[model samples]
Target: MKRRGPFANRRLARFCHEEAGSILVLWIASLVAILGMTALVFDIGRVQIAHGDLQRFADDVALAAAAELDGRSDSITRATNAASKLISNPQAYGGDGTLSGATDYTLTFLDGLPAADTTDPSGYTTTDPIDATLVQVVTTPVTLDPMFLRATRTLAGVTGPAQATVFAESIAGFSMEACDITPLMFCKPTGWSATQASSIGDGILLRSGGQGAAWGPGDFGFLDVSSSAIGSSCFGLNGAKLIGCLIGAEDNVTGCYAQRGVTIEPGQKVGLENAVFNTRFDQFRGVMSQFKSNANYTVAPNIISGLVPQGNACGWNNVSASTNSIGLPHDNCFATGGCTRFGTGSWDYANYVDSNYGNRNGILEAGEDSHLVSHIPAAFAGTRYGVYLAEIAYAQTAGLPSGAILSDRDETGIAQCSSNVSTNPARRVVIAAAIDCTKHPINGAATNVPVDEFVELFMTEPVGTGVGSPPSFDLWVEVIGSAGVAGLGAAGTGGVFRDVIQLYR
Candidate 1:
């Protein structure tokens, strides 16, 4: 063993006590903490960026899905398809950078949303597609691997979650507004459902409600088209305004009615304005006699009303008894005055064809008859509306001119009154709001009366005050089906609906 002197022992003690390199030791010790903190900040920022990307994706999906909730039976299916296929966005940063699709998110159709965003959606959501007006979308959770958090935790011997999960959720609502719609509202027939296939082709007798009286099923009233309800376009004479709206011209009433509610016109709206409505049949009468050549008040291309000329205009009394007349007849129950409003979809089809087209057998041999038969099902062949459409088709393809005389009485399917006939056949179809009067009663000038649905009504015949004409306040129309149905010609094309979609959360 070697022995150290006192001087060497003193030098060793001083070196141990020296503090010259103390800062380097301290800095080395803190380097691990500094790196861990940096890693935490970077990982947190990446997670936040991923969350933001997911939120944007959710918002887009919700909007796309909500736009298809049009109160139809396939609303949910349509919405799901729209959401799954319409939107495709890539989530980057902390996520795996995958494109979004049906599998990336889950959708919930809701009839109503809770008052608070934090409320559970299971309680308010619905499986019924027709009733769902809201949609909620939640993205699948994305697992993130932190850049250094896991390694730092392992080195520190800390037991915790190795990976972080992040996701986003959003809610949206859909609403509809009917723009450039006719200013007409009628009580929905009892037990009528817009989605019911059986409701189509039924005849409906819409009668005007007495002034200041509560409206009921089959009763109709004018909508408030005053400047307050619509806009400045309808600021003229009350009669003229009403006639303009009924005419449905481009320069006429300009406004949109929300599906949620509408304002009822005030005062006595006595008649259905037979003169204005008669223009559609090419039979101008009363005040409408002067607009015979006006394009705005054009007549339907096929104006085959069963009336013979009485002078310059056709008279309602000229109609033939039985099925000799080409005009669409009312339901048997309605003709007998037994049914008040809705018809039982039963009519005299054979007699009608026998009288107008020389029997169904002869007409079936005509050109394009096979095509017509295929389009008009046998079940709908008896319907007044179906027959009317068939007549128009026959006139087009069977070499029977639009103006060709149908009966010996000089009743033609052409507009003799107007030179510029309406090219759009829907001129005779009135789009009216159907309201559930029992649910939301209307006394007089009701505000915000909820509408059940919008119905497309085909004018079965012209309104007139003639001896044989229906009461001026009564309107006879055949149900073409509810507007916005899945597949019902132009009415199903969503022309009446102005959809609005918005994000809730």
Candidate 2:
């Protein structure tokens, strides 16, 4: 070194020594900082993983709670137990990593829905929605602290704490339909004895004030008569007086017929009035007297098809009035209408059979249609149009074990009522639900009562008696979610829900 001033040399020496020690101190400080930052990252990542696990556990607990609810009892306790088994820390407190001042979780019940009365006016009932019956179990929310950084106030600004919470919800009940049976079985055709034929009306007498023609025993013949187009004309009948005759071979004159025979329409219920037909005009005079009969008769025509009968006293030749009895057991036929006395062709006879009788009611009269077992009576009448069944017994079995009473309107605009079917697999009450309110009906296999249990229950009970009456129904449990039993598709999905529940008694 060259000769230098004392102040300059001393300053240079101090700079070298002091600055060298300062660099080592800085390096050591930076290493410590790096280690602390690395430790913080580890703690944060571990806590994040734990939080995710707890969240999944909460979800599992919710599903468990719903399943327990399906048992039909003890819902809240079951939910709590299920939650404890799922979450890691059963008693984990909610808050900023502190047990104090935390929001406690709890399991609770949801109230059920009200019942419904669908009887009397109509024959169906319904249940409430599923969302209204849902219950829930929730866990207490808590705040967790970061392990490394939280220990020091200086690192507080680096990371923040987070809160965790979990929640779960579930649903659970059966559905039912029934009918009513009552008095008045019309003409017991199926059960009647052969000797019962004597019970038909005696000598036919036209009840006064009634329209149409009536006939008593008489004989007459026609020949060489004056033909009239629209009015009665004179004709030689047994060489005596003649009236209302048309002599033309092919002429069809209204109120004037002395030519040939008439052809009755097919599928028509006809009434005979001591009258016979001649196929040819040449035979008209020779067989005129053969058209007569010895018995006095009052004939009435009724149309029976399917399960209904259509007729009015106005169309019958000798009906005193449009009587309601014709639609009842004695007057109506089950398979066909009326008797074919003089001629025999393609005749479809009436066949009346039910679980009650198991056979035909009798031969259907020409003026009558469909003669099945007379579960209803002719003299029977009701204030309203409906079917009523009473005094039915209920059993626990799946099969419908009872019958109901019914009252229905007749063609004469009267209410005809009837009842009395046995209780067994053979003769159970045919409880039916009408799709439309206006028309009386029963459940059909396709568009109506498709379910076996539903049909059995309905047939066992009375579906309110009367033409337009509905049955009584009770709506009980409505299930939802994976745990619920009332929905159509697989449970657990979001769409799983019970839209309707119907019960019958």
Best candidate, lDDT: 1
Candidate 2 deviant stretches above 4 angstroms: 1-30, 68-74, 81-105, 108-147, 150-357, 361-505
What's the TM-score of every candidate structure?
0.67, 0.28
lDDT, candidate 2, 216-283, per-residue tens: 11101121212222322222331112211121111222221100111111110122111121111011
Task: Give the residue spans of candidate 1 off by over 4 A.
Answer: 1-41, 60-132, 136-167, 176-180, 194-197, 223-243, 246-272, 314-326, 350-380, 396-402, 447-450, 465-472, 485-501
- lDDT, candidates in the order shown: 0.70, 0.25
The model with the greatest TM-score is 1
lDDT tens readout by residue for model 1, 417-453: 5676766667778878888888788765688876767
